[model samples]
Target chain A: MTKTITLLLHRGPYESEYADLAVNFALKAREKGYNVNLWLYGDGVWTPHVKNEKDYPNVGEHLRKALKDGVNVKICSRCAEARDVVKDDIIEGIPMVGLFDFTDWLDNSDKVLTFMR
Target chain B: MKTLIEIFRNTPPGNACLILTKNVLSVVYGESFDDKIDEKMDITTKDFEVQLHPFPSKIAEENGIEGAPSIYINRKLKIYGVISPEEIKGLIEKAKPVKIGIIITKTPNANEDVENILAIGEEALKVGNQVELFLISDGVWVGKRGNTLTEKRLLNLINDGCKVKASRMHLKACGLNKEKLVDGVTISDEPYEDLVDLVMEQWGKVVIF
Candidate 1:
């Protein structure tokens, strides 16, 4: 069975090295045949919003590809509330859930990696 | 005691013992092997034993040891095993050649953190160095009870002769009850400042996790 790797993104995409490293790791893990899940927390909730802008390469596009390739993307509800992000504003394919749900996902995972900035 | 002797006695027949050498034979001899092994060996064998080993760095790379002054017994890292009390004693005897300091944050969230530090400290102590843990900030709450991870780890460290201290101001800020802290843990009125001074005063390398 493929191992599950949970990446906890705790910072906004642009401000921290965590997002880039996490995306890179997720893509690499997918290529390596591991099941990957990315949980966006704290400022990480802004990741899907900046996905497909004119100047931006669209992180959400990569996330979408990751999803298509079988990666699960989740954003924390508390973090979204703190950031004033509405559910409608969330990009399609990314689900927003509570911290407890995220913890359950982590507990069920084979490996958990936390990216804090 | 028999199991302890067998484990420490010059690497068993089928088991491969990887030894790391640093600062010449003196430091490695001082910290890596149990003192009982040294006491058991004849003077000629002791001299020969020290001379036979290569540099620690080379040995580490050759044996896939990740860090300096580490040992791998039975292809498993020694740190991951269920080490017995006797084995622990042997480790302490061998590890006294160096000095290591550990710092833990004393807070409600620090229970797990302190436990890990204690585990690492036990390993360090087994390697023969004096190990000291300084708890500061909210980390002083490591002494708080309710069967926390920190309490379990602290218990192990205490058994292994690791010194644990908590800061006074942090304790007051957290409103910690003095009786609730784990036994054998020293509570100081100025633990944080004392910890800082100790960090500055001693230890060649300081590891905080």
Candidate 2:
């Protein structure tokens, strides 16, 4: 049976290494042939709000790569609203979800990691 | 303080109804005034012509509100206080063999987070749920011998059969090692891998700080 790993990212991008690590971990886990999920909570909602610029080592780019590589990603809708990050401000295809949705991921995951401050 | 909302909601003559919140009443009628309302906010619906009247606090006292935050549906007291969020979540979740994973990444003594974690960890174990704690980053400081408040609480969980592990790499970075850790605290050679195994295979739920 294939194992699933869920990563909950609670920090914003650029300000710290936490978000980048989570994205990197997700990519690495995916490379290992595991099903991966990325749940962006709290300040983590700022992660996908970035439309990455060229030539910069942006965490958003890594997140987009992970998303393209079959990583299921979600952002907290309430957190996004608090930061004034609308649906159009975030990366395409990622969903703005609720707190309970993270629990749903937790309930289904075999293993989970929380990347935060 | 909490406020309870209730609608008298009679037969209504048919299908029309009106709703007024406390906030709206304060804005219109002013918080201090008590006036006999001869005119009503009238609206005609398919069924009934409804009259909406915002009642006063004095009338609420007449409705058997001996204490505040009490609701009166129709001359009868309903909710007296508030229902906690935990109670609601518990109602949604079933009792099962749940393995709880806790990851601590901050220094303790600055806050009672470790104490809270100890309480939760003990309760989980008491209820026959498996509990695991991973001490990483500055969390390695929690594994020290004399952790003040953190040590006593952490040792309690360790003695209670909770699996407590510290990140060896973080311990080294923080100038701490296995020898300086609590008696039963184990050091993970590869914290990330162990964390993955803990979350991915060993545990069903996780709480990270």
Candidate 3:
């Protein structure tokens, strides 16, 4: 049966390979015909704001790919605002959801994987 | 009897530090000393990993009780001072492994994260804690054909009821065939996303390395 998998990413982009692993897992889930959700919390709200320039592993690009695969990508508003990430600073199509959204997802999701650094 | 120094040096993380000051001091200096010492030292932080012991009188010799207000990290002397709660918190965090999901993405090499995970996971098991390890990305190599001590330990962990798994895609990515995998690994047919969810649903904490 198809499962609704929630990837709760708690690490920021570029600082480590966690964001990449999160996106990779989401993509792999999508490939297997599962519903995926990427909920960014803690330092992870910094993911969309990461600059995608040059040889650096593009966290934005991977997140964009996950979105393309129909994964619901969201960021914690409070966390983002704490890091000075205004709505305009985030990647297009990504929404700044509230902390309640994560709680709701946690209750509804069939599974949850947290990528904590 | 283990010295307070040894206890402090050997104290595991997430465990509380016990400081035994003389009861005589509590009588002479007034209970205010206990109150002051306890107030000044708060071990439990945002997460409840480490705790502060409010000077219990029992088990005095276990604490190497030589003097009043003797500070013990795992029952060892930590010298008298305004103990840095942050430092104690850090030590507690480092020494303890909570019931959690540990994902290994890096290939096993000399002194790699997998070895640490295995050691910590094994220790947790000894203490009757649960540790679920997922081998994804290059970490699938641990499940692939190999008879190294590390790989053998992976199998032993599985046989011992440890939840160890390898991603089929990752195994394939590493050019490993499923038939070649060491026994006792759950090769998920659901893909990486499901595996992530599976681990998370079961564990309150996740550590990726």
lDDT for each residue of candidate 1 in B1-209, tens digit (9 for 90 to 100): 01111122132211222222221222334555453444323223342223222224454455554432233432223432234435544553543344567666435462465556667788777654568776665566777765555677777777777777776766786788678788878887755345434543455445654
Candidate 2 or 3, higher TM-score? 2
Per-prediction TM-score to the true structure, in the order listed: 0.41, 0.55, 0.49
| Candidate 1, DockQ score (0 to 1) | 0.02
Ranking by TM-score: 2, 3, 1
Q: Tens digits of per-residue lDDT for model 1 on A1-117? A: 666767788777767445655665576677667777899988889877764555754566666677787778898988898889886776787888988878888788765656663
Quote the lDDT for B82 in model 1: 35
Off-target runs (Cα >4 Å) in candidate 2 are A14-21, A48-65, A75-117, B1-98
lDDT of 2 at A19: 84
Q: Which stretches of candidate 1 lie over 4 Å from their true place?
A: B1-209
Instruction: Evaluate residue B51 in candidate 1 and report its C-alpha lDDT on the 0 to 100 scale.
Output: 24
Q: Which candidate tops TM-score?
A: 2
Give the TM-score comparing model 1 with the true structure, all chains together. 0.41
Better of 1 and 3 by lDDT: 3
